[model samples]
Target: MSGREFDLVLYGATGFTGLRTCQYLARNYKQGVRWAIAGRSASKLEEVREKLVNIDPGLSTLSIIQADASSPESLEAMAARTKVVISTVGPFLKHGEPLVAACVKQGTHYVDSTGETPFVLDIIRKYHKEARDKNIILVPECGFDSVPSELGTKMVVDFLRKEYNLPTKSVKLSVTKLRGAVSGGTLASICEVMEGKEGGMKDTLDQNQLVPEDVASKVVPARITLPSVFYDHDFKAWQAFFIMSFANEKIVKRSHGLAVEADGVGYGPEFTYRESMSAPGFFTAALASLGMGLGGAALSVGPLRRFIQNRILPAPGTGPSDESITQGHFTVKIIGESSLPENVPADASADALKPIKAIATIQGGEPGYSETCRYLVEGALCLVQNEDRVRNENKITGGVLTPAYAFGHILIDRLRAQNVNLTVSKL
Candidate 1:
């Protein structure tokens, strides 16, 4: 009998996102690293391995396991052999529940790339209790959808406590920079949900769970969501509508509920930040908003949703090229306000900017896939690597925790080492 078990198993390794995840694992794969490629197709897994072999001959040590998402027995079998299972198989509301159930029941740590907030909320509500008891980490949106943004927000809040004072009056995250196209898979998932093809994620909001349910919900969040037109005192930067409440808003809301120290800060002050890209002409911004308005509306109905998936994305596993993903750029510019006394001078107190602030960006081929693989895997790696002790310490886990709380300085240091753009920027 082979005594070795894989450290991580890449479930759904045959999808577009799955394939990219495998590529990332390959680049970071070490000789003794126990990892495997898994999905419904044996031939496709073999094909991916062959391509990997072309990239690096020594990767022959990589393993393969054929598992079908439809089969719970197969999922449970896959779960037992791995400490952590990072899955890219989504449209999750459609093809996910089985694997998640298996992981939780078997005491395996589970992570997935999902922005379907309602579906995740359902899983947590339905399974978080059991997983918590098992000490299993069931995290979703382990992708560009929110990890870095969530983790970055957590870092800024921690910085406030360590430097200026304990607990930030308020913290905010704005998309100062971001540019990318949605994939077919992304579009397809949206279409299904809009068309009612997606079931099992209806009560995410009332459940009060960001992605998980049954956790205490009275704490403050690390980041706040402001108005579309928040005031930036120093820079006087007036940000336009960056409609991210779709994913980020929910995560931030959950983070507030799961916080350990900043429980008093409340769900961050209302500040909606954005990177207004246009000709600076009123028409341009208006046009963009109109387009978004139309898209947003369509995202909820069957016809418009169907059109996007059919015309825009086209295939379930289709996405941008590796080169395109590698060449993308992302940015965020957030502005915050504090409880200033009457007559707070402008230039006189220019130095007194929101006790805490930060700008974080990750450059990669495809943020949704490539960079997400790096971020989520690193999150899992950080969690497993630094399970004991913390810069703050004495923090409790579970109940919709913040990424910073869950991962901490260990994660920040690791991300910086990976060359992610991180710094304290004003305005």
Candidate 2:
């Protein structure tokens, strides 16, 4: 048993997605779960608690505490009291490090829904070693941003390794169907990237900065251009640039790297990955690609970027209507290609050397908020419930980690229990 007073603490609980997360905990969290709601204002935290009580009247007695990003001491106190922390605070580049620092220092496990590549890379560079020493698991991208891609690919790689006894050589993921809008927090984080910080995505995207030197040296990534659209015969869909690819691809790479360095079970030494969304036809793909390119260009300009951030997008605390949340869903398909063993005879039949493929489908609801809440809350639960398994069975002691690196198949099992559809089959 953890020495902490609480099993979980939901920080930033007054924000749009944060409040939803509290409700999720109230409805689905097991009875006697010791949890609290926290944010900058005591009144706002109380308001959120009241709303949660409406969902589960028993929660009227649930705890509420004050902890602000600007108050490191408060964050420290909050961290010290919880076994695990689930943070929904974002533009994490701007408002996240304090809580992360406190968690690491306090020896608390931490998870967040951050897609800020620069922030994640910084965490890796600065805190991974220390967290490892302290037996702390610091996992980011515990939401829609990259969970499906990171863990979906892991599902494929795991299947291939088990079925054919071979490593995965290359993989492509296509968003086949999506019906969701971005959250205000996610948009804010994207705008923060466009506001142009030094050593931001540019540096993260420069040379696969997410992977360590030793692992990166063994793998060669396929060349991919984000502004281009094309046809993918294998998936039988027109493919277009995916804005989130920069982060998702790098995260999947980090998972593979950890497999080699920590577990010695990898997709292969030369594994490569790319991501795109499937379009109806070539025309739709071309138009979508052009729009994304133009949007990127517009966001890079100071005046346009400010106008979009200030006037057009939702505020950090706001979000789409509840009806929209109910109507939202997403599906992604990952195709994994097999790598031939080195000792295969040169005279082997063409059928023997032909690229074998497996497909993994990951589907869920209301990606930006609802499904994201499930992923985040379930991920936190995985840490709380399976920390010993991750440490002892998986031998994944600690580090700045992707969901797959931190929890392995344990997370997949948790999601399956939550009714998430994760299916894999040979193609």
Candidate 3:
């Protein structure tokens, strides 16, 4: 890794998020941090480099590597040249596996902004053992799909343990404030998942399907069921089905599972995580819930999905207006409830033993694009700058990992420094 040609390589640099990530790197580029921009088109990569050079003239000399997701040899070459790779290419189900395989073959650490859970489960099942054996990590969903959800949950779990010395029993996350637009890449990925092209939506429904068998074995199956639309007393807001919850909840569960495997204890034996989008009133919540359900139903059908993809949604590589990207924002509120400690008196009244509670919030700008670029770039830097520390501190040998398990507090600190606020307190 020390002798690698570059410290990091931004693959798919021409894509919407990839271009944003390149700009982010240019604006925040540190001295002596060797990095390169790569994609299938040398011309597109050069164009991106030119834009970056405008931000910093020094980037005029920035290297460009021509690599395509379809070309395994090119991907391997790119992977071999860089110690770490950040991929923004999607819908990953169609074009992601080759690059991941190449990265693992080249022993390069990898990160991506993929939200497709079936693809993630596929990678974990196929490459986790080999990646672990090679001592290289591959972390997907480093972007808005689940980074905030996973990391926010970790913050609450840590608070419960440090403040009250109690294990977390349940954690609920609500997207209380979200003002953002969809990206073409994101929409494409959603279409693919809805079409059942990559292992189907069923793969994402069960928590056990997303994690390794050993880790899943220790998890206590959840018993409580939540409605699609409900009023949450904790947040005093009506809640609806959050589009990203299917992916986020599974990622959070995997993080907890990995923690349990690492230490024999995690959030807790009965820990369960659920997520929803908050609305101002019950009517809004109901409308949102119905809209999402209808949208999903439409996407699941062949003709309607094609119509939506071709006529309604933006094409791949395109996204929201710059103003939308600049003005968009989101806030997720996380609540963690503590379980009874083993030392509780046998005769203690149930009413007297109230579960301790903690709240954590993750705030950022433009969930689908701007803030996601920051999460993707910072996540890659965390791996680059704290490789040995993260591995040693977490007792992780490397594999397909969630953001919290892979970067933990290092990533949290990085995001905070970037003004992507993550805060926690006792309630």
Best by lDDT: 3
- Runs with alpha carbons beyond 4 Å of true place in candidate 2: 30-32, 197-201, 221-224, 263-265, 345-348
Ranking according to lDDT, highest score first: 3, 2, 1
- Candidate 2 lDDT over 207-266, as tens digits, reads 366776666666675354456788999889999988888788888888888777765546
Cα lDDT computed for each candidate against the true fold: 0.62, 0.85, 0.88
lDDT of 1 by residue, 281-361 (tens): 445446656676666566766666666666766698888776777667675543333333335467666555434454333
Lowest summed lDDT over 10 consecutive residues: which window, candidate 1? 270-279
Cα deviation of 96, candidate 1, in Å? 1.7
Task: Give the worst 10-residue stretch by lDDT in candidate 3.
Answer: 197-206
What is the model-wide C-alpha lDDT for candidate 1? Answer: 0.62
lDDT winner between 1 and 3, please give it. 3
- How much RMSD separates candidate 3 from the native structure? 1.9
TM-scores of the models, in the order given? 0.82, 0.96, 0.96
Each model's RMSD to truth, in Å?
4.8, 1.8, 1.9
